[model samples]
Target: MEENFKMVAKTLFGFEEILAKELLQLGAQKIEKGVRSVSFYGDKGFMYKANLGLRTAIKILKPIHAFSVHNENDLYNAIYKMPWENYLSPKGTLAIDATVHSPLFKHSLFIAQKTKDAIVDKFRNTTGQRPNVDLKFPDIKINIHIDRHQCTVSLDASGESLHKRGYKTATNIAPINEVLAAGMILLSGWDGQCDFMDPMCGSGTILIEAAMIACNIPPNLMRKEFAFERWQDWDVDLFEKIEASLLNKTRDFHYKITGYDKAPSAIAKARENIKYARLEDFVHVQHEDFFKTRKGGHQKLHMVFNPPYGERLNIDMQDFYKNIGDTLKQNYPGTDAWFITSNLDALKHVGLRPSRKIQLYNAKLEARLVKYVMYEGSKKQKYMK
Candidate 1:
């Protein structure tokens, strides 16, 4: 039997709790949460399961070594002493990604270079040959983290970010990150119980993620690759078993999941993405300006999307936000409307107050994931002050 080891699942801001919950539900042991990360114990097959199943995780890392370092030499010496041959061949290609939160190491790039140098130098000294650096597609990807002089070197189990689920061949002007899209739906507390909609679905990322969530589908079932596939001990049979196990757990979703966009181009892109995901049966995309549309049914509706944050696409910030509020209040009754935007000023113009506002970051921009509940009956929209 394979022995269990510790692994860390990295996620975006405000998603640690949900990621932790996901790990727990997936049968992870001794789960611990960190800022934008969750650490837990699982065996090799479980690691395969995590990379395949975790929706919010950007990357899954297996920490191989941890030490205290104060200077560059210390970092190099630490990495050189490790048995890199166990994970990669001397002729294999390698890539290093580093994150520094310590005052001692000011440059993350330099650290990455130094780590890469140490590994290749070690290979050259021992085997008379060294691995080449291939940043794009490497046989091994390493992660270096320094926090308050404590350095940890980890093997990245997921090569590219898990967000590249291989289903999005097309995108609109401003497509939301797949990880963030999945996190938003999970945080909204929608579990396939009600109808789902993304009113301003740009390329239908939110809609696809929401539909996957509602159907209890593994987020990365359609992913092209995981870093572990190139490892020295890559177990094809074990990975297949894990994939089969996750697929068996998928549940059927009965409610409708839909998206609307004003632009015909966006509608076309959304349709393409939905089709790529093989979710055409469960999701529908339409060309309609959200501000001009009304709720179709009396069923409880769950809405989540990322509207224009006035960053890339050119749109009237204040007026667009006001229209969002007016449409929800006047038309979308019995609905829980949630949207994320970096435009703090524009949120005020929405007119309707948000019942919940959670702080998060959309890349470098500070953003808010706000929620507004519209009443079903005679009760007017309660604008929380």
Candidate 2:
């Protein structure tokens, strides 16, 4: 029988609950949600399944050791004491990523360097050879997380952050992050039952993510590689079996998923990315400015988008936000419009009150996911909800 180990699935902020629910659905036990992460228990095969199946997760980490530390030398000594040979060979490659929120150690990079030094020193002292560092493509990726004085060292089982679903080959000036896009669509509770749209779509990220969710597709099926592919006990046959099982679970999709971008260049890039995801058939991208277009049909439209947030603060974001509200109220009735933006100062200009507002983060900037409900008529532009 395979052994069950603890694994942590990391995700973006505001996705912890959805990720926890996803873990529960994947047969993971002892599911626990944390801020921007979810912890669960699973075996090697379960780890493979989690990496292959979970759409909302950024990476799955398997913790190997935990200890108290207040100094750099303590961190290095603890790392050196671990059985590094059990995971990788002297000829193989390794990568270390450190995240620290400790008053004792303020620099994350310094901690990563110390951890790497410890691992290399252990190998050199024991076998006179050390594994090389390969940042882009490493055989094993290690995660060093320090919260206060306690540190947890774990093996990163999902490489490339899982957001690189190997689908996007092209992008525009403001293409949304895949993981964030997926989480937002899921949070909006849109399945394949109704029509969907990304009115101001920059590069069709929301559209592509919606199609995958609607079809019950494995988000990482198009991905080229995962960290487990380089593990010592990597079983290709087991992986294939897992992949086939996930493929078998994909259900049929029966809704129209569409996207529109004002710029012709953005439309072209969205088309290219959709093609790369092999979902061109399920999604349609067109060059159309959201403000100029009206609702195509009476069908309830599920809309999700990330409009331009003036990072330079040059444009009058207040006016752009007001336009967004005006366009939805006047043109897109009988629809639910949801979008994320970091421009809080401009939110007040939207005029229409949001029925639901959730706090989120876009990189370093604090953001909000706001929803406005449009009725079936133009005269009553105010949100019904």
Q: By TM-score, who's the top model here?
A: 1
RMSD of each: 2.2, 2.2
What is the total number of backbone clashes in candidate 2? 1
The residue-by-residue lDDT of candidate 1 on 152-251, one tens digit each, is 9999999999989889989987689999999999999999998999998989999999988988899999987899999988999999999999999999
TM-score of each: 0.97, 0.95
- Candidate 1 residue pairs in backbone clash: none
Please report the TM-score between candidate 2 and the true structure.
Answer: 0.95
Model 2 residue 301 CA deviation (Å) reads: 0.9
How far residue 122's Cα lies from its native spot in candidate 2, in Å, is 1.7
